[model samples]
Target: MIFSEEILKWYRENKRQLPWRDTRDPYKVWISEIILQQTRVAQGMPYYQRFVAQYPTVSDMARAREEEVLKLWQGLGYYSRARNMHATAKTVVSKLNGKFPETYEGLLKLKGIGDYTASAIASFCFDELQPVVDGNVYRLLSRYFGIDLAINSTAGIKQFKELAKKVMSTTNIRDYNQGIMEFGAIQCAPRKPYCLHCPLNKSCVALATNRIAELPVKLKKSKVKLKHFNYLVVVDANGQTILEQRKGKGIWQNLYQFPLLETKEEMAAISLGQLKDLGLGDHPSILLYNERPMVHKLSHQHLYTKFWILRTDKVVAKAIPWEKLPDFPVPVLIADFIKRFKF
Candidate 1:
């Protein structure tokens, strides 16, 4: 309730010296916000610098190839973000005439910009008095106010937005928003928060009532379903590995991957005939080189993957362009697998 001056002062003194904070450019802010989503500051920092340095403007990003964009975003998970970012960049370049949409509503209309991102761009760049309610803000607000509402719920989101807007400093919205967010990240952490040293300890409802963890209430997340996949990493004598761009609408749709055989669970063994059944090639004399099950965890899916690195004496007649393995963009997990196996 009474969270204004103290938080702002603390933030002014303790905010992390991030590169993104140095600029008030909406496009740059948008880039940083998107990169920071589902990513840690430590990891996302370098990516931000690389991306900004490469594509200085929205037009630059738009002009870049999808494969090139994905290559830059290689190690970062959530390939969809990269795809959407490209699409949005093109939208800004073509539709908006190379000018970033200044209004929150206009920004929200972009391919990937959501409420939180739009708000961040608006406040940080445009100096609009809109509150940015990210995960950190949500946690801090939920704990400080002792809100019992499930943070994921529509009602909770509405309430938090209203509260955040109320406390947002009208004169210095950018600093205020950044302050609260930094405070939550550094002090009011999700697990084992440093409450003893926190400036808000005296006024914090969670600290006073010993309910810090419990206060940031959230709906029980849906259990991540386990999916079993057997990736056939078939390579020829020239050391070129078989890779295909995923078609249709699903995870990593445009990203490249090896021939995959999906089952309910991990299979004891897979035959060469199975690879042929998937329309890979005929007369497949596949010699299994490596067969280790790698468990890859996604946001909602747990992939129990069995990678079968098979070597072939010669290229299959039906195989398409195996020499261009490095041309296509792939998910980080697949990319990592390739790099490690030297495929």
Candidate 2:
């Protein structure tokens, strides 16, 4: 109980005044939790504000189009999260009568709601006795208890979950969960934690053992594969540009982008002849070509992208006015090209 008491004490004095913490609204909590996954608070805060402003409620999000949701989540990178959140919103509205699931088990049934998110929503919104074990919790608990197990391993996950449940306050589970997560985020940080001033310094096993840097181990990530993309920005004399929706299960799914020609590697040589081979009609004029390819790195893939501006007399289907390009949702890579080219 002392561990919970100390963490709550520290939280009361040091917790950041985040927007999501101000309300017990399940919808807002769900949005904030999803946005903050694999994202830092400072970076995700604006997106949360924008999402809440645009879609004030779960029903509002459910009624909105996927294109509109993807447009708002343009730079957030994880396109699947946007798609899943949209699907879950619709489910909540259609099936649950717009009321978010009140229990951890019920929340886990929703799309994109994992154990951590479900536990967060259930406990924070409904005050359920569920402990959240996110990255922050893993770090704080692993270090404080000096557990050497790899946090990603099955044994470590089970052990940490049990420990988290044990330490969580029954009467104040919401603040206890928030306190420990916040404690890890600020005080017991991944790097250069404030051990000297920590309230639980005397009891912290890692601090006592001088192993603060080594307690929370993680498995090494798999190698990132490289992909080369050649995007053709096709435009006709009428200033209409063609955009296509990505149809497959891959990065940027359901988002709009320029005509893409993926090659085994960076094209050995790009020319009009190669353009014809890529299915573009013959005699397409190359107005501009970025000789220098831009590199965009994702978690598991590194993309080498080159954008070429092509002019063709032949009519192209799905062509929209160039001035109205912003009306559609495109990947950040394509968006950057548009901004740079002022298209």
Candidate 3:
């Protein structure tokens, strides 16, 4: 198809020579793809280099402690991806004998390897001839072909996947997939794409019909949940404090944070009386570290957080000393708090 032809030709001269693109190894491709899932190229590049440098191979990651993995991935939000990637690495080393599955379907058996990731690894490394479809691909296909379906809807997703497969290049599938995605990322961008210079501009239905801004439709996002967190910075004369690992199946699972007391609404005033929720029976003293609550916004939740300093002569068990605070991987919110905090 002319669409496929033009995209590949454009990709040949215009594609950025990213570090991951230089290597034929699936390891780099896998890591880079996962990192870029939620992060832009420039921001994710350093992280990719650091992470791979730390754990150079699947065995290296599988054998390393989970805390170490979380530590390297500390600043990157969406901690679950790190956890899942770690788990998948262990599985890959143990069950698959330290080699990644070659086929698209085989890669999906590994944790966190969904359609997009599997397709990426399969096509880029193994030449499986599958297309990787993410938001960029969705925007590209939606604009060039003038698909107005909501990219998030079930029907829209199915149609887009089929269309991506239909339009993918059969001979040079690696460059073909890369070209389309690069084209989408750089040329057919979400905001103010350079339509005049776009190679696909003449054939793009959205450009032709003046629908570039509205072509890739999406449904409204779910209401952002507002949550309040009161972190107790308990100390007992010694420069030591308590840190608890988050338990459960969520983004910050296995990560550490201070003693957290969650309330339905923002507390009018955090009192020493509120120490009971933290299982502390009437702490001797309390002080609000930050007079104003800091708001940390996530994809679907907004956390209004406040820190309270609790002073007590009584010893608290399992308290990590001030010097050891950096050892554990806490959420970015907590990490930021630590940096600004004196102790």
- Best model number under lDDT: 2
Quantify all predictions' global Cα lDDT against the true fold.
0.83, 0.89, 0.88
Candidate 2 structure quality by residue, lDDT tens digits, 1-343: 4889998889999989999999999999999999998889999999999999999999999999999999999898888999999999999999999999899999999999999999999999999999999999999999999999999999999999999999888889999899999999999988999998999998999999999988799999899999999888887756688788999888899999887889987964568765634334777777546777799888899999888788877776657888888988998888888888854
lDDT of 2: 0.89
Write one digit per residue (lDDT tens) for candidate 3, span 1-343: 4888998999998999899998778878999888888789998899999988998998999999999999988888777788889999899899999999999999998888899999999999998989889889999999989989899999999999999999888999999998898999999889999999888777889999999999799999999989999998877656678898999876598999998989998776667666754444564577888878899999899999999888777766767788899999999899999889985
lDDT over C-alpha atoms for residue 166 of model 1 = 90
lDDT of 1 by residue, 102-174 (tens): 8899899998789999888988999887899989999999888788898889999999999999977887888
The number of clashing residue pairs in each candidate reads 0, 0, 0
Mark the regions of model 1 whose C-alpha exceeds 4 Å error after superposition. 277-283, 289-292, 317-324
Which residue pairs come into collision in candidate 2? none
TM-score of each: 0.92, 0.95, 0.96
Q: Answer with 2 or 3, whichever has the higher lDDT.
A: 2
Candidate 3: regions farther than 4 A off: 271-273, 276-283
With a 3 Å backbone cut-off (N, CA, C), the pairs that clash in candidate 3 are none
Off by over 4 Å in 2: 271-281
**Candidate with best TM-score:** 3
Give the range of the ten consecutive residues with the poorest summed lDDT in model 1: 276-285
